[model samples]
Target: MASPIKSYVPYSIFLIALLLRPSSLTTAADFSSSVCSGTLDPSRCFQVIKTIPGGGQAPSLESLCGTAISFSLSKGNQFHSYVQSLAASASNPKLKQVYSSCAENYDDFIGNLQSAQVMLKRQDYNGVSTMASSSMTEVDTCSDSFKEGSVADPSQLIDKNKYYYTLSLIILRISNKLGGAA
Candidate 1:
């Protein structure tokens, strides 16, 4: 007959294994698929996130959002500066008006992104979503200023706006997955 302690040893080991198992173990590719599933352009979303600087390896959703937000903020500021420069240099009154309005709109866009970051820090996912969505809308409002055949369409701005919106959606999805935050 085996000793009582020895008889229980295997069971104890099994129990320990069960308790130590990770609750959610995911590879970078798996995380990408999960995050991109809700987006219109999942491939692009996956590609963008997978290629984040200092983030080739798997990253948690929070880190991914922070990286993407940093990029988006940089682009937003660049667009604003571009508009300001255009406004200052333009001889045409109409062009100056469009550029000035776009500069203001981009200013609001940067503010919205900043507010979204604050909300995310507070774990107020709904507030983050609202601010991010509002930021994207401001991009459209800026683009529309030139849409009456008054000025040429800025394709780069349009593309950047779409990309930022996708990032916002990813952030919203991640927040939602973290439970009831959104």
Candidate 2:
């Protein structure tokens, strides 16, 4: 029979190689699909993620969550500023009122997102989800205000609101997947 030590040489090398390797190596596409899997609309989630700068290459699930919250915050701030400018410039009293209300809504939305950012830093995924849901409610309230006012929709304002709501849903769903704190 072959010597026992010689028989085990190849097995030992193989085990060593396995131990040295990373736990799992997944491609960016794999990461995207997995990260987007549990969302309300996986397809939309993937598309939205891809639209964010460097989003497609998120190295891990937590990083993906960060990307979503950070992008939403940035977009919320931009929308808030836009609404404020609209509120200032709108000549029609009804339009001005709608814009002013939207500005306030955006303010609350931004606050929720800011809170979500903190929760994300703390790895409190549930807390982040709650904040995202609250942010979505703000958007919904703003949309409802528009419908109630019957003001002519400003160029892209309504569409942006709808899009942000969808983004908020994405954030909430993704955060839910992580469960509670790490």
**Model 2 clash number:** 0
In candidate 1, what are the lDDT values of residues 1-182, reduced to their tens digit? 88999999999999999889964666656666777887778888876666556444535666665665666788678878887888898777876787788789889988988887887788776777677678767777876788753776443554655655665566556656543542
User: Which TM-score value belongs to model 2?
Assistant: 0.79
> After best superposition, candidate 1 residue 181: deviation in angstroms?
8.3
Clashing pairs in 1: none
Best by TM-score: 2
Each candidate: RMSD? 4.0, 4.0
Give the clashing pairs for model 2: none
Which candidate achieves the best lDDT against the true structure? 2
Q: Score every model by TM-score.
A: 0.72, 0.79
Off by over 4 Å in 1: 1-24, 154-156, 179-182
Looking at candidate 2, the ten consecutive residues that score lowest on lDDT are 173-182
